[model samples]
Target chain A: MNLREVGLRDGLQLEAPIPLAAKLDILDAVAATGVRRVEVTSFVSPAAVPALADAEQLAAELGRWPDLAFSALVAGRGGARRAVAAGMADLEYVISASDGHSLANARRTTDEAVAAVPDIAKLAHDSGGRLEAILAVAWDCPFDGRTAVSRIVDLARRAVDLGADELCFGDTIGTTVPGRVTELLGRVREACPDVELGVHFHNTRGSGLACVLAALQAGITKIDASAGGLGGCPFAPGASGNIATEEVVYLLEESGVDTGVDLGKVLEAAAVVERAVGHELPSNLFRAGGPNRPRGRG
Target chain B: MNLREVGLRDGLQLEAPIPLAAKLDILDAVAATGVRRVEVTSFVSPAAVPALADAEQLAAELGRWPDLAFSALVAGRGGARRAVAAGMADLEYVISASDGHSLANARRTTDEAVAAVPDIAKLAHDSGGRLEAILAVAWDCPFDGRTAVSRIVDLARRAVDLGADELCFGDTIGTTVPGRVTELLGRVREACPDVELGVHFHNTRGSGLACVLAALQAGITKIDASAGGLGGCPFAPGASGNIATEEVVYLLEESGVDTGVDLGKVLEAAAVVERAVGHELPSNLFRAGGPNRPRGRG
Candidate 1:
């Protein structure tokens, strides 16, 4: 399984103002864990999400490792171009499928965001970095209720048609279940068989792992998760925490799905985040001390 | 989507010594919520679990309501006999599928526990109460590891042949996923076409709702849940919090699975337990304030 760590970008984006040194240190530490992909930061305006303003500084200090894919979230052509200039080799852009969230979150409509995807993809491609488009709230929008399956399918087609290397669907509201996941996957795969399908699940409803299980059953191999389940939507009130990365590995490995991630290392990264964020992570694996921790004898 | 609230028996068993009057109050409050079934208490020895020592006393004062079935967990023949004397109409006897958990949790081997099911069922039948056998650690055991699918299937057969009216699979250690649930159900259903199947899931891994989703997809109608995600295995370290009753209803209802449980009423009942337990319930629905709570105008 290809597990992408999104704690730095999506997770930290919701957290308190983290120091730049801590960001670089955390990014370097995460790279050491052998999870090939990490969404390092967002190239958006610092005023909106000040935590990730040091995207350039963090990417500049991002240590190189064999087969590591360092990526950043690019909101539009400006962020995409900035990411290219920042020495990033992979880029991911966010586009909410729900127009209401698109406006509430980004001050843009769904169509406006979709229109920007192609130009962002062009900039990423022209700058020699592969681009992936994340359909935020693809399954549900906290402001608009559930997003339609047909809507996501159409967006997948449009994103791919514009030259996205991958099309990632996100249950931004964390209200998705297996039925919804299976429903979306069946339609999306049929519509865009050539696209690499991925999903981002939040543990808000405690259905994160279930959604992952559903996605895995539907043959999705790429997943975006936060170490210690650290990410949440800032715009969506009460929407906190993504599916923990260790949880994804735990569920997959427990079910004999090889995630190729060391759970202990992930837990260690989680501990680092706990210290950086000054709070305990909400991840079950983080709190439970994992399955293989030594138990004290009475 | 039949939800059996188990806060009194399974949840309170792990909590601090809640007062008998408080227990009775919570039971009555939960009953008023229109939930069809509630596992009122356990008939185990007071020395073993002093919290539920007032089982018979509470049973005597149980408020009657139309179509409400109050049940109790009976450890063995003695407990079953005690429940019969107490006027319980439904009795669920627990047997661990994993040998280690069985010995550690109940001081018996798997076969010894299975052998006792016959007499217990006979006692239940003689007293005009139906019997159900719950295979604890049916999917995974903390003392042991994952309980083999075959083990639970064989236990299901023996319990049914011994006169159990229903067989319930329990994720005693909170280590089950949808894949494991689906695997166990397909084989259990095939082996016992005449018996009813149920499951008890804990949210220890945050996959409780997912496990319920899988079970429902596999045609399981009866589920055991604790109100407010209470309950934990005393012997299993870090295994705390069962699947929340309201979460089960919320998940099912959101997906069109009619639970016949009023979300508003369940939340009201959760509040009563929260005050009695002296802590805010950790259920998603409880914390999220339900799907219809008023949003701020600001």
Candidate 2:
């Protein structure tokens, strides 16, 4: 299974600004977990998201982990060009499925966002980078209420047609339940059977990990998570950070699913993130520790 | 689906002592959620658990919500008598599935605990109460390691034969995953097809709600949760609170399973719990709020 670590990018985006050196340290810790992929940072405007303004410098440091596949999140054609120019071979282009979220997040309608995907995908492909179209707000939109599964299906088809090498559904607000996860994933899989699929969930409403369980049962292999459960959508209301990578590792490894990521190393990375963020994280595993260690009276 | 709120009893057991008046206020908030059953408090020696030393005083106030069925946790025949005397018609008799936790929690071996069950059952039955044998540490025991399925199956049979009207498996250390949940529940259901089965999970490992999803999929309807996700076992090492009640209600109701709980009311109860405990609780829903209302920029 491919567990992508997005803490350095998504998680740090919502937190207080840490120095580039601190982010590199976090990257080293995340890479040490043996995870195959890491979303190094996002190629957004420095003025818009100051927390991730050092995307180019961060991308330049990616050569230290040749064994790891690193990706950057891009919002538009300009961000895609910047990411590819910085030598990032993998890129994730996000398009909110709902018009409300799209306008709030990207300053455009969902139709305009869809129209921009092809240009961004071409830019990524032209620069020898693979594009993953992340359909944010795929499950529920804070402004639009419950997202229509048919809308997500249509977006999945469009993304696949637009030269996206991979597709991921983002439960932006973490309101998705298992049944909805299964149903939506099943529909998308049927619509784009040949496309590689993944899921991004928030622990906002506490159904994040449960949705992962449902997705795993639905035959999904790629999962996007953050160290220490950091990062919430600045645009999506009532949202929290992505599911904790350590928690997901604990869940999968204990259930006999090999994620190839070391749980202890992930916990170490979470500790590093917690310190860097200057506060506690939302990860239960980070607080409770792993199962093997003795705790409480036992 | 019966979602039994255990915040007042199990949730408060691990926190600093709150006055009886504060507990009644929380109880009123909980009852307003429209949940049908609640584990009011545990009937134990005051010296052993000073936090719940006022179990009798709290039980005396149960008459305020005659529409709600109330249950109390009992460790032995004495506790059972006290609970019955306090007028709780629903009694949960807890016995650890593993001898390690059994000795730490009940000061007896599993055999001795099983032997004492018939007497406790008779006490509950003679007083017109139903007995639910809660098998604590039924999944992984912090002291004993992973509990064998055969051991749980054997205990389930004995508890049913000993006159338990219902059986509940407690993931005492919150180590159980979804596959194990389905497998264990399937085995127990096969062994005790005639008896009602339930589950008690802590979010220690962040698998609690995922485990709840698995149990619901396996057709196990009775779930144990705590408001604000409060509580942890003092005896079980590395344990956390039961799955948060509002989170479960959000998961269930959003997934089309009618828990008959008002999510807003449960969140109110969680707010009351947070204040009484003088700290933020572990519930994600409590922090993020529900799906409605505008949040963030959206």
TM-score of each: 0.92, 0.96
As for model 1, its CA RMSD to the true structure in angstroms is 3.4
Q: Give per-residue CA lDDT, model 2, range B216-265, as digits (tens).
A: 88999999998878877533322366789988998888888888888899
For model 2 chain B, give the 10-residue run with minimal summed lDDT: B289-298
Candidate 1, what DockQ?
Answer: 0.31
- Among these predictions, the greatest DockQ belongs to 2
Candidate 1 runs further than 4 Å off: A233-239, A292-298, B233-239, B292-298
Predicted complex 1: CAPRI docking category? acceptable
Q: How accurate locally is residue B18 in candidate 2, as Cα lDDT from 0 to 100?
A: 91
lDDT of each: 0.79, 0.84
Question: Could you report the DockQ of all the candidates, in the order they appear?
Answer: 0.31, 0.50
Q: How accurate locally is residue B260 in candidate 1, as Cα lDDT from 0 to 100?
A: 80
Can you write out model 1's per-residue Cα lDDT over A1-298, one digit (the tens) per residue?
Answer: 8899988988888667889878766766677666888888899989988888788888887654546778898888898889989888678998889898889878899889989877888888887888898998887776787788999889888888888889888877667777788889999999998888888877666667878888988999899888887866444322257788887887788778888888888888888887888865767667667755322110
**Interface RMSD, in order shown:** 5.7, 4.1
